[model samples]
Target: MAYWLFKTEPDAFSIDDLQQAPQQSTFWEGIRNYQARNFLRDDVQVGDQVFIYHSSCKIPAVVGIATVTKGAETDPHQFDLSSDYYDAKSSKDNPRWVGVTLCYQQHMPRPVTLKAIKADDAITELALKKAGRLSIMPVTDAEWTHICQLGGTE
Candidate 1:
C-alpha cells in the first residue's frame, strides 16, 4: 500500500481532536493547493497508511498514524460560505477542491519530533525534510519504515 504524510496545524486539528471525533474519522479538508489536492484526488485510496504530522507549531512532529478510510470526494467546505475554506468558484457540478477521510489508527507513545527525525541518518533524504512545506506528500516505503521505527511501532 502507498504511504503518505499529512500535515495539520495542531491548533486547527490535533491528534487529540482526531481521537475525540466520532468513529475517530474526519474529512481532511481546507487544502487549497492544487498539488496537495491532486495527491488526495489522484493518489490516495482507502487502506493507505499515513503519518499524521503536526506542523506550524513548536516541536512539530509526527504524532500518530491514520488510515485512509475513504478516498477522494469533493470537500463540502468548498460550498459553505461561512467556512474558512469556502471558495466561490467551486460548485457541486464542478469541484475545484477535494479531500479524503482519515481514520485515527493509533497515537505513538511519544511523538517523533522533527528535531529527532532530522538527526536520524536514515531519514536524511525524506520528503518531509527535502520538500519541507508541502502539506501532502508521498512517503517512500523505506522512509515509512524508518519513521515507524523511530516512533517505536515497527
Candidate 2:
C-alpha cells in the first residue's frame, strides 16, 4: 500500500482527538484545496498507511500513525447546510470535494519533529520537506520507513 502524510492544526484536531474518537476512527474532511482534494479523490485508499502530522503548533511534528479504512468518496460535509465546510457550488450528483476515513494506528514513541526531518540527510527528499502548505501529501516507501524508524515506531 502507499504512504501519505496528512497535516492538521493540532488545536483544531489533534492526534489525541483521533485516539479518543469512537473506534479510533474519523472521516478526513473539509479539504478545500484542489490539489489536496485530488489526493483524497484519486490517490488515498483503504489500507494505506498515513502519518498524522501536527502543524501550526509550537513543535510541529509527525505524532502518530493511521490506516485508511475507507477509500475516496464524496465529502458529505459539502452538502451539510450547517457545516463550516459547506459548499454551495457542489451538488449531490456532482460533488466538488472528496474525503476518506482513517483509523488511528499507533502513537509514535518519539514524535519526529519537522525540525528533525529537515535536518536529516537520509530523508532529504521527503515530500514534507517540500510540501510547505499542502495539508495532504504523498510519502515514498523509503521515506515512510525512515520516518517511522525516526519516531521509534518501525
Candidate 3:
C-alpha cells in the first residue's frame, strides 16, 4: 500500500484528538488546497498508512501512525451551511472537496521532530521538504521506513 503524511496543527486537531475519537477514528476533512484535495480524491485509499504529523506546535513532528479506513468521498461539510468548511459554489451533485477516514494505529515511540528530519540526509527527497505547506502528501517506502526507524517505531 502507498504511504502518506497528514499534517495537522496540534492545537486544532492533534494526533491525540484522533486517538481519542470514537473508535479512534475521524474523517480527515477541511482540506482546502486544490492539490491536497486531489491527493485525497485520487491517490489515498483504504489500508494506506498515514503518518500523523503535528504541525504548528513547539516542536513539529511525526507523532504517530494511522490507517486509512475509507477512501475518497464528498466531504459532507462542503454542503453544510453552518460548517466553516462549506463551499458556496460546490454542489452535492458536483462536489468540490473530498475526505478520507483514518483510524489511529499507534503513537510513535518518540516523535520524529521536523528539526531531525531536515538534518537527515537519507530523507532528502521527502515531499515535506519541498511542499512543506500541503496538509496531505504521499510518502515513499524508503523515506517511510527511515522515518519510522527515527521515531523508534520500526
Highest TM-score: which candidate?
A: 3
| Candidate 3 accuracy as lDDT | 0.94
Expressed as tens digits, the lDDT of each residue in 74-133 for candidate 3 is 899989999999999999889999999999999999999998988899997777887698
Tell me each candidate's RMSD, in Å, in order.
1.1, 1.1, 0.9
lDDT ranking of the models: 3, 2, 1
Which stretches of candidate 3 lie above 4 Å from their native place?
Answer: none
C-alpha lDDT score of every prediction, in listed order? 0.92, 0.93, 0.94
State the weakest 10-residue window (summed lDDT) of model 1. 124-133
Stretches of model 2 off by over 4 angstroms after superposition: none
TM-score of each prediction = 0.95, 0.96, 0.97
**Worst window of 10 by summed lDDT in candidate 2:** 123-132
**Which candidate leads the pack in lDDT?**
3
- Clash pairs of candidate 3? none
Per-residue lDDT tens digits for candidate 2, residues 1-154, read 9999999899999999999999999999999999999999988989999999999999999999999999998899999999999999999999999989999999999999999999888886667787668989999899999999999988
After best superposition, candidate 3 residue 107: deviation in angstroms? Answer: 0.6
Which pairs of residues collide in candidate 2?
none
Q: What does candidate 1 score on TM?
A: 0.95
lDDT value for model 1: 0.92
